[model samples]
Target chain A: MAALDVAPAARRGRPGYDQNSMLEVIVEVFVDRGYDASSLDTIAKRLGLSKSAVYHHFTSKAEMLEIALERVLGELERVFDDAEALDLPAVERIRRIISEAVLVACARQQYLVLLLRLHGNSDVELNAMARRRELTARLSRIFEAARAEGGARDDIDPALAARLTFGLVNSLVEWYRPDGPDEPAALADTVLAFVRSGMLAADGRGPR
Target chain B: MAALDVAPAARRGRPGYDQNSMLEVIVEVFVDRGYDASSLDTIAKRLGLSKSAVYHHFTSKAEMLEIALERVLGELERVFDDAEALDLPAVERIRRIISEAVLVACARQQYLVLLLRLHGNSDVELNAMARRRELTARLSRIFEAARAEGGARDDIDPALAARLTFGLVNSLVEWYRPDGPDEPAALADTVLAFVRSGMLAADGRGPR
Candidate 1:
């Protein structure tokens, strides 16, 4: 999760923005201008740094993209690993994983957004996408396990259920503002509640 | 919905692709290449037609974008109008709207995908975003009404609930395939059921 912070000492030689801060600006630029359309010059201009200064942190735009993607993908992989190690039931693990993912997404919103927008146009993008597919498949297997344990509903397909559930989580990237009124904890609670029993009142009638 | 089909008779003077078909290829190109990056030449090359042949349907790329957006926006507006006309409770109307949106999205996947990707970079995009915001506000009001009438859980903010619900629907554009095993009817049912009662077994435990 602190992959960017791991090399604060490496910034001693570089003046102005450090590696973490530089990557943050670079990612913002990438998100605003499509990655394919964004060049090193565009990123350098946005950062108000010389091209060499930008190059001081990352060798190429593709490297920046790869590092940014790894930050999010690595965090997500950790979530899955931790969830799998738990002694709890598959249903509980699913809930915990989703709750943790909400926190990760909110904390690393820009990285996650960049990761989500990628369409595998390059080798770095393709690698990120492959990792993403593996994570998705892992979640689907958890859903399958939950259904098998009779904890989750059996009627819906597990793969479809996993997609819808995480899709709801991923949609937060579209509107979630870190400085907004809803704290990550409260937002996570709301998501969990909706995923648990939905928007209808507890006493409301069932689906027709 | 058939905005592109309105001028088919005008195609008699043109050769190769007709207005509707040309616009379809243009949209596909726009989706593949970001709208801002795509030009008339790029669109024509994708369609295997000359630039003037491409121009036979529309005067400019913006015009094509406007027409394409209107197709999805117009269909959505019709859904809202029809839902408002129903003599049901606010909660039921919300259900119908989400259900119908899934169908519209499934039928016009590319247009909806394009609409969802738009970031309001231009006048046409801004107009589409404005219309989209109005639709979201309308849905939020319905959620508010449902809450006031005790049909929906009041704990979650109505606006947040509206965004999350529709966000789930919108995410369908990311992964849904028309020729996939799940039919639109079945998809709609799954979505509605998930929105209504969520993914837990009927007799399952509540949220922690």
Candidate 2:
């Protein structure tokens, strides 16, 4: 997330409270309670902000969703901007994307959790869904290119491969506890290991 | 699911309305609308069952959740009950479980979707959580034994391995459309192929 240096002029209700921090609390409620059931009153109560104060920042629950999704999409889009993306072999770039996704998800846990559960209930959600589909399509092209370059197998349909790959990546939202024993780096390596080599020992190398 | 032959005297309101099929419709609502938002009235309206008729079959939404979970948990448990689960090599058993899980998940799509999203909101959900944990522990033991026998790699922590393995299997709930191109059989083969061999072609052998 960007630094929380909102100019004082943009501040909403209280001098101490910032819009970003209020958004953080709101997203947390959205995560704990499904978005539809979450109300401005509930969000304001959680943050100790008055409902009118919340309105000072975001006009409606839908607006809050729009603002929160913008931040989440921004964080995710940075995956494609990694320096290695342009210079590496397509397969290598794909690996970098997978590895970085785990890190990004860990860093932006709450936002990503909300992103995954989205059902496209509103215009904002539909746009988020389109962005997600676009990202998946981008990965599919990379997978297809990797196959053409003879860097990957073609046994699985490239489209299906893209979907399953995202499935494994997004499943992080389901069970990744920040307090867990495995850190993002180690977990990424393990995921890469399973993706690069079958769970069985490397061919002809005896099991450890 | 229990046998369809409920004693005639035990039949709820309409002779035509049955528990298993009604449970199917109810579970779908739970999947579409998160469980808390799903009402007995909504379920009854879907089935054309009067509210009291729903009560005849289920005392409350919690009871409906309990009954539905029983079928889902039963379907999953039967995987471990497979003769192969006991007789095959531990790693083979693990592989068989992964393969069968996809089939069971596809067979019981609505129920499994509900099962995956379970949040332990009620005693029923808590029981489902316990059953799911038991399944995960069983798989971890299988993974540990499979590693000891040199049928699998030990590089990944066994418990982490169990979680990720289940994540991949359970992810089918997110995207496995019944109308999709791949049958459960084909998708199982694809999953097994990825699990047994990473999407990248073999390390040494020439590409097919």
Candidate 3:
């Protein structure tokens, strides 16, 4: 369960998977063991490479961690950029943003775990936290706009709503297994429907 | 901050915070550095006790983790017991349960982080997870009873709704700070009110 050992025949056809691929494997190891406890030598052993070979691409373990985090942040920044460019209705934009979030979490499972566990005490975490806060503020503004447009209920506090919204999205990393049970799209859809319609069906709205 | 430094002066007057107090400090450190990375010697040094002295109460670090998790489980069980004994309506019981959750999260912040971070790989985590699942099932039963009494939306999937309900409750561990701006009761009220009435004022339901 540590690392998948690849055969020599499989390595010949694989071209794109190089330093980045090795780094991703190291990130998974970091997520398993506490980052401070995980060693570069262990990571190198997992990749069937010498420690110097691993260090050839990256200077140190900290550099590997930085590169992995940057990859995740870069993907999220791109998602935010795409969400910002869309001129669709506010609720639709939110739905798309959440869906994209699920996709990212599913695709980059270890990186997402690393991102969530950050305490902001380190320089890397602090920088990532700032970016995350900015992204959250952006989402908060969108929620407010949606409320203003009567796309969502006006009674809900936009800030609180945004927190709950992210909570729902973030919970995916805990229980969502890409290899098990439901497909990612279905899980995302279930979450989207719950968010939009509440837990009640149209007929279940009661006397109101 | 890693762990609190226990001093000689503080020990003389207040009858000294016991092993339980020291365990609380160690829990905070574990939450920060993670379980495997945190050492008993650091906990001992933080509390101004020798490592041998710290080892007297708990045989191993993992036992300390078990007790911390058990303490949280104990609180949840107590809250549920009180909620069950209350002869109020089902909706009122649910409200009380949610409010209790907020209080518990605020009071036991470090323990809550440990509970949330449990990976279910260890026996302690697996046991705690089983208790959690049972608690969720119990809450779902109350939700069913409430719906049967014609208060809740009948078309809702009780399990999914239960997940969302607890999702809102458990999420406080991620961000709610006791030292932060909002009061626990007020924040719980806001969440409960919004959840019950939703964003529409016309729905007209108030917190029970």
Candidate 4:
């Protein structure tokens, strides 16, 4: 991977840069430079710290990856768990899950980007992919249940719907700038609006 | 990057593996191993050809990448160009662009995947990204026109809608299998159905 275009001022690691901050930088580097190309040495150099200082927090690059993946995956799984536990209708539960997921994805955009980019090169990546698949499967089941309950359209496949829904949600990481105009809540609202009613006017006079 | 798990039988180059076939293999390796990690040596080995044979078709790895990116980007640009020439309403034109884009994406899944994965690491990648942004901008303008025509809902931002629409469409690269059950036409239909009307039933009695 090409070296990151880091400014010299940004290279100076802030005093008391804790493990969480270090992991954030690590995830950012991993995303910018492909994980395979990124190393602890490069990461330390970016942070303006010695390799030993970086190693004080994490044992290996894979461990850092695991921690990052866990942070995002764990949050998503919790959203799923909480949504599934709700007494609301299946469709309502689906909405809750998607809305919460958009928020989680926005909040943990870098980690989510790394998680999405993984091609299962290592045990950590493979495990993360498995968890992601499980999450999708769980969402598919909810869609199936919603269809059976007549809350969702029956024509579309549940698995396809689940994938496409999350696909749109996940795409936010590619262009969503937290510093940009759209707040996370508003972004989630727009996403929910699109996923719920789509872009057509209520009159339904648009293209077939 | 870890070596691709090529079967022994598949390692041998097929008879008459011309430039088109060679480009296909080159793209496959590039996507699997990543563009930066991939090189002429690795690609030649994967194709069971000598480095000179690989060199006969392309000058360097960058040329191969440029050719692969052009295949997808060129097709998408054609789609946009054709859609713009249509004498239909803005909303209908938007539908045409998206449906054609989905078809292009499915047909050239690998090339499209590489295009989306690019982060401007090189001039070739930056050029492709610029063309992609232009395509998205065109789609966003169509959304704006559609909203003005009262065919699409005006509540959401036009640019955001365009991105989310294509986001769902582009997500096909992650999990779509050509040998899978859903045909490209059927997949496009489902996507169009979702984009036109969302997952909710026509009764609109589902989640808020």
List-wise, what DockQ does each model earn? 0.40, 0.30, 0.24, 0.42
lDDT per residue (tens digit) for residues A1-208 in model 1: 2442322432443466777778877888877766766778888888777898888878888899999999899999999999999899988998898898888888888889888877666889899989987888898999999999987888899999988988899988888988898798788888887787788775534432
DockQ of the two-chain complex in candidate 4: 0.42
Cα error, candidate 3, residue B108 (Å): 1.9
Candidate rank order under DockQ: 4, 1, 2, 3
Candidate 2 structure quality by residue, lDDT tens digits, B1-208: 9979765674445457667878888888888776766777888888776789888877688887888878878978888778243767777888788899989888888888777776555677888989998988888888888889877777876777788777777777777889977799888887877777677755465211
Instruction: Quote the positional error of residue B118 for candidate 2 in Å.
Output: 2.3
Model 4: per-residue Cα lDDT over A41-155, one tens digit each: 8899888789998888888888999999998898899999989988988899999988998888788888899898886668898999999999999999999999999877888
Worst window of 10 by summed lDDT in candidate 3 chain B: B199-208
Per-residue lDDT for B58-94 in model 4, tens only? 8888888899999999999999899999889998998
Measured against the true chain A, the candidates' chain A TM-scores are 0.89, 0.86, 0.85, 0.89
The candidate with the higher DockQ, 1 or 4, is 4
Better of 1 and 3 by TM-score: 1
Alpha carbon lDDT at B114, candidate 2: 74
Best by DockQ: 4
Best by TM-score: 4
- Residue A144 lDDT, candidate 4, scale 0-100: 95
Q: Please give, for residues B8-119, the per-residue lDDT of candidate 1 as tens digits.
A: 5444543566678778878888776567667778887777667987777788888899999999999999999999998989889998999999999899988997887776
lDDT for B181 (candidate 1): 88
iRMSD, model 1, in Å? 2.9
Give the Cα RMSD of candidate 3: 6.5
